[model samples]
Target: MNIFKYINEAWESLLSNKMRTILTMLGIIIGVASVISMLALGEGASDSITNSIESMGTNTIYVFRDSSVTNSKTLTLSDT
Candidate 1:
């Protein structure tokens, strides 16, 4: 029931099943690596988008004309 007894039993079990231990360790390593890679990729993509938006001047404005409304006024350079 002591911690040392539990540790000894676990060690013995692992040693007795070498293949299972190796496979379990390999799975854990691969899972951790995959998670890290995905997080890094997501962060890189987010930073890229933020940098692109920031590089565009703050005064920049985008206007989209609605084709569904025939009565909408068209934007021209003189309107600025």
Candidate 2:
């Protein structure tokens, strides 16, 4: 069979079922849009997290004191 003939047949079939064609196209569009939106949301969240971390500075350290270890010398800003 010729490629052009097959293309013509497929096009005719799609035209015959207008509703089906529209529905199929709509489904494809929705699926692609949802995927794009999800990707954008994930990227935005990742950027926000990265920015938050970077803003805090890389050399920053968190020190949590335990009540069990009571020392006379308390943590001061100068120590950090």
Candidate 3:
């Protein structure tokens, strides 16, 4: 209810438990960093997929004759 009391209590607690506060902050920082890295990786994967789709050959019917055919279905930029 009181802003001054809240501030005073927070400051006192922080000052008294310096190492604990810093450790908690570090955990939060690591979580945020991992979340950012995952998002960036996801975006990169999506962009690559988009580029691949855009460069697909037109009127080329993909024949999935065999699943073991590695070079059969994949169309690279060179094929575009």
Candidate 4:
């Protein structure tokens, strides 16, 4: 009923089944470790992609022309 009594009972229960206690702790440790590792991996991948995009200069632009347009002419140097 009191704090110390509750703590004592909880400790006793844990100690009563040694194998179960160990297995439960192992599962919790493994779950936490896996979650942390996955987060680190995702952060690393995000940073890599960000660095790649930044390295390619911000002023880069892409142009697309439809070849199927009958009268469309390709721009030449003098057309600029």
Candidate 5:
């Protein structure tokens, strides 16, 4: 029922198994670092794509010819 007793027992256990404690701590650190790096990489990639789109301006037009559609017409300079 005493909080200090539980804390003392946990501390003793951690000290008794030094290797296990160290390995567990290392695993947690590595897992957390990997998650943080992955999130940062995803955020960076998103920012890069967003910047590229913004740099192209809102009036940018993309033209593509569809080979599957025979009725598709090619864009001419006069169309713009």
Candidate 6:
């Protein structure tokens, strides 16, 4: 059988299971929506942070260590 024929056959099979197809499409829609929203929020947050950092000063060096290391350093507001 040709590729077109096989594709048509598969499409017909999928159509026959309308409920399953709808559920699958719904799943894809939810997944894509979640990903898009997350990406947009993340980008917006990053842009905001970059703006804030740039406005602060070019000499600032932001460093982050693990929780345990921070505890050992006796970190406080004075470090900032």
The C-alpha TM-scores of every prediction are: 0.77, 0.76, 0.71, 0.76, 0.79, 0.66
Q: Which candidate order results from sorting by TM-score in descending order?
A: 5, 1, 2, 4, 3, 6
Please write out the lDDT profile of model 1 over residues 1-80, one tens digit for every residue. Answer: 89999999999999999999999999999999999999999999999999999998799987788889978787788997
Instruction: Point to the candidate with the largest TM-score.
Output: 5
TM-score pick, better of 4 and 5: 5
> Model 2 — TM-score against the truth?
0.76
Residue 19's lDDT within candidate 5 is 100
Cα lDDT for residue 13, candidate 3: 100
Give candidate 5 misplaced runs (Cα > 4 Å).
64-75
lDDT of 4 by residue, 48-70 (tens): 99999999888986568987889
The sequence of per-residue lDDT tens digits that candidate 2 reaches over residues 18-42 is 9999999999999999999999999
Q: In angstroms, how far off is 67's CA in candidate 1?
A: 12
Off by over 4 Å in 2: 63-80
| Model 6, position 58: C-alpha lDDT score | 75
Best by lDDT: 1
Model 1, C-alpha of 51: deviation from truth (Å): 0.6
Q: How far is candidate 4 from the true structure (C-alpha RMSD, Å)?
A: 3.4
In model 6, where do residues sit more than 4 Å from their true spots? Answer: 58-80
Rate residue 1 of model 5 by lDDT: 75
Q: Which ten residues in a row have the lowest lDDT in candidate 2?
A: 64-73
Clashing pairs in 2: none
Off by over 4 Å in 3: 64-80
Distance from true position, residue 74, model 5, in Å?
7.3
Candidate 1: which stretches are off by over 4 Å? 62-76
Q: Would you list the rank order by lDDT, best first?
A: 1, 5, 4, 2, 6, 3
Q: Give the better candidate number (1 or 5) by lDDT.
A: 1
How much lDDT does candidate 2 score? 0.94
Candidate 1, overall lDDT? 0.95
Candidate 2 global Cα RMSD: 3.6
Per-residue lDDT tens digits of candidate 6, residues 1-80? 89999999999999999999999999999999999999999999999999987898978866677765534665588886
